[model samples]
Target chain A: MKTKPLILISNDDGITSKGIRTLVELMSELGEVVVVAPDKPQSGMGHAITVNESLRLYKTDVFEDLGVEAYECSGTPADCVKLAKHHVLKDRKPDLVVSGINHGSNISVNVLYSGTMSAAIEAAIEGLPAIGFSLCDYAHNADFSHIRGYVKRIASEALRNGIPKYVALNVNFPAIMQGEIKGIKICRQARARWQENFDERKDPHGRLYYWLVGDFINEDPGQDTDVWALDNGYISIVPCRFDMTCYESFPAISQWEL
Target chain B: MKTKPLILISNDDGITSKGIRTLVELMSELGEVVVVAPDKPQSGMGHAITVNESLRLYKTDVFEDLGVEAYECSGTPADCVKLAKHHVLKDRKPDLVVSGINHGSNISVNVLYSGTMSAAIEAAIEGLPAIGFSLCDYAHNADFSHIRGYVKRIASEALRNGIPKYVALNVNFPAIMQGEIKGIKICRQARARWQENFDERKDPHGRLYYWLVGDFINEDPGQDTDVWALDNGYISIVPCRFDMTCYESFPAISQWEL
Candidate 1:
């Protein structure tokens, strides 16, 4: 008999969050699931790793009813993926690595600031086939019901077809309240940016503090962009790579006299 | 005469690190300098932003001797850039944004985990020209004397010719002790990763803890890669973009049945 695929799971949301719990339940149906995730919420942690501090990983019964083995780590999302790959599952290669049914969107430029996507990206860096799933909702109790089947299908497709090497799928579904998710579209990241507006406030200590808030601005009008797909009520699957090199700029920079 | 180009400087290292000091000294020679860096070291911070907490920014006299206006912020490197552009600088547009003379190398895949490069990447996302510089040495007081002229020339060239839109240059210098500095090579990010090894130990209280330590593994043998340039004693300058999309993988994913 063929052994079931071993699937490793993680998320930027703390291990006990509804998001990771949903992810755990979904991945459990597909493989032998093992989870290593942050002990606290790690939203907006990007590709960060724990360098200056020691980390603690404690096994938890968070997914006891689901029969999923889990460990909660005191580190960033990237740290969880590293510890999972290096220590928790030493010499045991996972067939697929999944991160997040994130509480918020990680479309366009937000991917660079996403702890959820960073976990998947970190897994890809380790040569693992990975996927990061997110819904276009920011509520702590965001409903992930409508997209459960899609998530399973996507993960299954990834397992059967295998994601392209060195890439991670950033899959985002429209919020359930946003009518119906039309379908999935393979797209590229749109040209977008966050227009920052710092909310200045005076604390009780008489010192000024600021809250980092921003309005996302999507400048790309291309129909092939992830932002466009999301706006049209479609799930977007953008294959994100770790190589940040802009090869097109080579000719321009090569002419520089150094 | 035209006012000297305003150069906003920042780094992953704290405002008081020897690396930022060297960067400030070099940038001051080329333009009007404004420094806004982290209050404490933020080495592996990647592109993290402080979302759940308020941030404090205080005017500091660290660069007062150089007559450079500076501020120290209790946040990550990316926060400093956002704060600098949105709150500190306000409507005054900077001509250039430069981060680091980082005390260590940020070559190859290290760029993804680098707080130094995150500052520059954040600037690029804001539609500004930026560059991140690093030295191969990891010492706190590494020698910067040898690469002084090269640093000046690179910044001068950037000031004269704007960086490609939505891109930041990742410039890394070979450590001074690594033989004569050869020249500069505009290269691509090499295919490399850190082979993470968790150093597990027990606390005095008998609780087990782990520290992340790794050996950088360069898997790419391409001569045009950043790793090759640095290994051969050349300064590597890779044009990095904010977009992480793998467009080539679109066709493969498009074939997925959803």
Candidate 2:
């Protein structure tokens, strides 16, 4: 009998989150699984590596009932992928790497600062097929039943037909009921950013402090953008890469006499 | 008299580092300067924001010798730019945002996890011309005299002829003597990554811990890459964008039946 495909999983919300638990349950149906995720919540970590600090990976029996091996890492999501590939699964490359089922949306400009997407991007950087899943809900117990089917479908498809080189999928779901998901749409990341305003407060020590708060503004009106798809109740998938070179602006800047 | 152009300065190496000090002194000669940098070293911070905690911005006399207004922010490099524009310099946007004179290089794929470059990228996302500078040396007091002429030249050029829209410059200077410094070259990011090997150790409680360490491997052999430029004794400048979309792979992924 052919052996089941091996799948590596991780997330920014730590290994015990309901989102990753849901993801593990769904992915277990597809393949043998190994999880190496942060021991504490690492939200907003982006692609950060723990260069100046030490990391710890401890074996755990959390997924023992599911017959899966798991480890808790004291590092960012990106570090988990690196350590899992190099140490945990040495010489055996996983068929796919899936991150998150993130608590909040990682659409458009948010992708740049997302620890969930960073794990997937790190896997792609290592020449592996990967995808990051996020729901447009930030509640602690957001419903993820609606995305289980889509997750299985996308992961199975990724294993069957390998993803393009140097690219990873940034998949997001609308916060809807099991039957409310309209279908999935592959789209481009929208042009968007946060318009920030800090709320200042005086500390007990008579020092001033501010909380970083912002209103997300989506400037792109195109129907093909991920923002549009998410707002319209469709699952959005945007292919992202690490190469940030602006090819369009290259020639223009290259023309400057310096 | 014509009003002097306003330039904002920041770095990942905290407000007290020699690198930011050099940057301030050099930028002071070109324009009116305001600095809002991290209060502590934030290397490898990536594009992180301070959403979970409160931030603090306090006045500092560090740049008083240069006759520039300066504030030390209790946040990441990216947050410094956001607070600088939104609160500190309200109603008046900076003409240019320059980050670093970094103690170490931020060339090749390192730009993704670089706090210095992220600050510049934040400014670019806000529709401002920005640049991030780095030297190949990693010492506390690396010789920066050789790059002073180049830094002044690039800033002057960026001010005279603005950088392209949605693009920021990731500039790196090689560690060399004054006369050995070659001319600047516009280049692309080299394909490279860190080959991580966590060094396992025992804690005081006899628990195992690991320190993250890695060797960088540049796989791209192109002559026009930033890695090659720095290796060949030239200043490397890569025009980076905040958009992470892989436009080439979009069409192929869009064809998938979902």
Candidate 3:
């Protein structure tokens, strides 16, 4: 039998999230899995890295029973990938990077705020084939049943074919019954936003406080968007890159004098 | 007499850093200044907000004698802006948002890892004109004299002309003496990156640790590039926008099928 592929796993919802458990369980059948993830949830920490302070990464046999190798990292999701590549897998580079199976959807503009997508993007920047997985629901007990087969198939295929170096995939599943999942759709990120409203409050000390709240608003109801894909009972796969140069508008913007 | 524009200021480096002090001092001449910034350094905290947890924002007497409204936030640069808009300034919307007289340059790929630029981006997303300023020097007491005039002129121009909605400016200065300050250059983002290298060490207990260390690699040296302008002793200005979609690639990518 051929040696197993080396698969590096990470997530924004920390090492103990149910999502990564399902992901690791699925990927275990495909490869030699190495898990390195944030010690706690880092949900919307877009591309953040712990630069100002010393980071603490500890090795433990946390998943020995799972028959997989795992380590916990005390940093953001992006830092986990970097640390994994540099030290955890020092001898050889991983064949692929897979982040999340996150509790909340990273469709549309949410990708701009996703620690999950940022991890995958960080991996892609290092020329690793990477994929980020998310579910539409934010519930702790969110279902991953509808996405397992698709996740395994897509991840294995990606490992087989090898994704283009600069591109990473952002995959989101609808929070529906397994049988209700229609199929998969490759689509663009929808033009959407979070209509923000902060909930104000007073602390026990009588000081004012506020909680950030927002409703996800889909400005683009077009069928070509990831939001539409999930809404229509299909999984969405969006190939993303991080060189955020709006090259098309360069000429128009270049006209401005300093 | 014309009212001085109300300019909100911040930085990733804690309020005590020379960066924000220089920014506050410079902007004071251009407008009525209000500062809401981190009490601690937040370098590499890209687009992070203080959610999923309680935040503590304290009004400080730092620079109190200057009569500028200054407060230190216990959150990321993005959070500072949100709190500023919602609670700090209940009377009026700020005329502009300015973040960073950063200790180091935030050109090219660095922008993706920047708290300062993200603060500017947050303001732009909130429909406020914004700018992020940086000095090429990373010294804690980096000299900012050479770029004071340029900072004032560009900021004043932005206040006068206003920016394209959803777009902000990222300005970087060369580490040169005040007299050697050649001129200002408006340019596009240069294609550059940090060639990542993680230095692995072993603790006394025989456990492994890794330090993320890297050198910046500039691939674009064109005159119209931000890096080139900064290198040529001219303050570099790159107009930035928050939408990360590569709309040009959408047509082709839309053709991909499962």
Q: Each candidate's iRMS in angstroms?
A: 0.7, 1.1, 2.7
Which of candidates 2 and 3 is the stronger one according to lDDT? 2
lDDT of 2 by residue, B57-154 (tens): 99999989889999999899999999999999989988999999899999988998899999999998888899999999989888888889889989
Fnat: each model in turn: 0.88, 0.78, 0.30
Q: Is candidate 1 or candidate 2 better by DockQ?
A: 1
TM-score of each: 0.99, 0.98, 0.91
Error of 2 at B197 (Å): 1.0
* Higher-ranked by TM-score: 2 or 3: 2
Q: Give the backbone clash total of model 2.
A: 0
Q: How big is the positional error of residue A207 in model 2, measured in Å on the Cα after superposition? A: 1.4
- Model 1 residue-pair collision total: 0
Q: lDDT, candidate 1, residue A170?
A: 95
The local lDDT score (0 to 100) that residue B246 gets in candidate 2 is 87
Question: Evaluated on chain B only, what are the TM-scores of all the candidate structures, in order?
Answer: 0.98, 0.98, 0.96
Choose the strongest candidate by TM-score. Answer: 1
Strongest candidate by lDDT: 1
Q: Which candidate number would show the highest DockQ if scored against the true structure?
A: 1
Q: What DockQ do you compute for every candidate structure?
A: 0.89, 0.79, 0.41
Q: Per-residue lDDT of A1-258 in model 2, one digit per residue for the tens?
A: 988999999999999899999889989999999999999888888888878888889999888888889999999999999999999999999999999989999999999889999999999899899999999999989988878889889988888878998899999999988777788888889998889999999999999999988999999999999999999989999999999877677777777777
